[model samples]
Target: IVTVAGNVERPRNFEVRFGTPMRDVIVLAGAKPDTDRIIMGGPMMGYAMPGDEVPVVKATNCILVGSPTLFPPPPPEMPCIRCGECAKACPVDLQPFEMYWFSRAKIFGKAQEYHLFDCIECGCCAFVCPSRIPLVDYYRFAKSEIWAREQEKEAADTARERYEFRLAREEREKAEKAAKLAAKAAETKAKLAQQEAAKAAEGTAAPTPTAGDDAKKALIAAAMERAKQQAAAPLNTENLTPDQQAQIADAEARRAQALPAEGKE
Candidate 1:
């Protein structure tokens, strides 16, 4: 069984295809194995596995064999002389030099202001730098910090949204209660008005005798006069025993004597 990942037949293994280099089989399947330059795996995270003679293993995914014409050699490294050339080549417009200085000094917060996380590691800054600096490494550290900050911001935003929603709900509930109270007051007022209207309507529908009305009015007046007399009865203590009545009369006489004479005035 000959297994081909990109092309050709499947079931290709060491047991199926004996004494044959895996590169040749891959080449036969329209894959260029003897390319001049090739990244073994992903460019950002993968390492170059040395030697073309290395046999294929199970861990092998895509053997990214490239050409020298396609992929050029990295620029030669030079000493970093505090030059600002890397800062100018930066596309995110971050001051790579300042960031490098701050990061080297362990002042992470100071480096963050320069938006160090925005660097895409395109090698443009490194390419233009007369003093070769690994700007990407510093950017990676900054990027991690920025990612952490983003998570914190997202959590805070969620909390804020929940608080706002709760406040709005409480306000809505309060308004509903006030509205219900107002509606109940209005209903009570309407009921009172309706009762008054009904009473007036009934009075108009059934006219009572004027004689009975006059008798009721007279009885009410008599009852009011009796109440008033009871209230004013203290002015005359004549109903008391003789000794008490005499004392009251003496007191009144003394009050009359103490009063100013009307005729003299």
Candidate 2:
């Protein structure tokens, strides 16, 4: 059911099918000569349609025909004087003046933090404003700008993530190539060492020791025996002078006296 009223020859309800063109409905209602705009709903909240060519949907409840007398043009906007009337009239209990200030100054993020999207765009704030400011229009403009900036930020972040991923992938590829080259070089070196060892074992024979070589081996054995005997030898104290023995005795006596004092403590 569709209800078409306001500034028409026959303002009444009609049973219409879905997807019905708004033009046919207007013709049935007979639009008045003074009709200057067509609204999809009531005058308080309905949006003005650009033309009558739009089709009626399931949500179409009322089609209001507006004229100069019924819906006059809005007055020139004035600066806000911090009046609380708009806040009082707001059904959502939002601070309209604060939102207006932020929106006018283009500080959209601050307006959003103040719950700007919670505004229903009911136009009550504008209607009750003593300065006749279009509060709803400012809110709408701020919302659009915030949305556009958010989209731009998201795109930039995605590009940055892609670039970082590309750099990481290139670094990983370079590391893998370097590792493969290092492994190949090590394997080649090991194979060459093994071949050299095999050639030495197959072709080279141990030469007979000369007199000089025998003498060098005998000297090295004697040095090693001397180092072992020195490591096993104990310190000799039999040759100490009488005066040195007396000094050692005195030191031992002092250590014994300090031990008794520490035990007492």
Candidate 3:
């Protein structure tokens, strides 16, 4: 509902259709020929439109027609004299001047310390300001900047967590691969020891390649092949850092030492 008042002949409420030109709505209410500007909403909280030719949106609740006598330009802003009238006028009991000083300076953290969010943007502080400072606009700006900073912080935090997780997963995979290779080497060494002991007890200086001996050799060969493959890269090591290269080299060195001993035996 559009509350059509000021400079119109029949000032009353009208169910103005959405998307209709505000000028049409004013004409419907019988606007005076000398109407200077159109303001949406009440005098204190409302803003003046440059022209009434703009189409009205759902937010256009009150259409107050303005003339030179009705709505004169606000006086030049005077310096804050700290009269403290705005504090008394504030329904929320806020220090409007303090918040205004911090917000105007873009020191948003200081504005927050003054409980800036508690402001309902009702424009009461601006209405009573002896300095004629647009206090609510400053508070709104501070709130918007605070919101933007919070979003940036949240995004940065998320990116850091993802990077840390990737690094941890890579290190974990490398450790797992190294452990498997170590276990396999230990098992192969134990089997070789058992074979040597059995042959020494049988009094064979050199064991002939019997079918059973060939089967045992094949088993050892298969285990060694598996250990070699495990020591190979488990995943792509592309673009690895120097630290990663050092870790991979150490694992390969451990495997190399184990395999050489087994091969000599």
Candidate with better TM-score, 1 vs 2: 2
Q: How much does candidate 1 score in TM-score?
A: 0.40
- Sorted on TM-score, best first, the list reads 2, 3, 1
What tens digits encode model 2's per-residue C-alpha lDDT throughout 185-262?
A: 999999999999999987878877899999999999999999999988876666788999999899999999999999
Q: Which stretches of candidate 1 lie over 4 Å from their true place?
A: 1-95, 104-118, 122-135, 200-265
Per-residue lDDT tens digits for candidate 1, residues 55-82, read 5565554445555544556566666786
lDDT of 3 by residue, 107-159 (tens): 99999999999998889988888788888878888999999999999999999
The candidate with the higher TM-score, 1 or 3, is: 3
lDDT of each: 0.66, 0.90, 0.90
Candidate 3 runs further than 4 Å off: 50-53, 151-265
For each candidate, what TM-score against the reference?
A: 0.40, 0.62, 0.56
Q: lDDT value for candidate 1?
A: 0.66
Q: What is the RMSD of candidate 3?
A: 31.8
What is the full ranking by lDDT, best candidate first? 2, 3, 1
Supply the TM-score for candidate 2: 0.62
Best by TM-score: 2
Clashes of each: 7, 0, 0
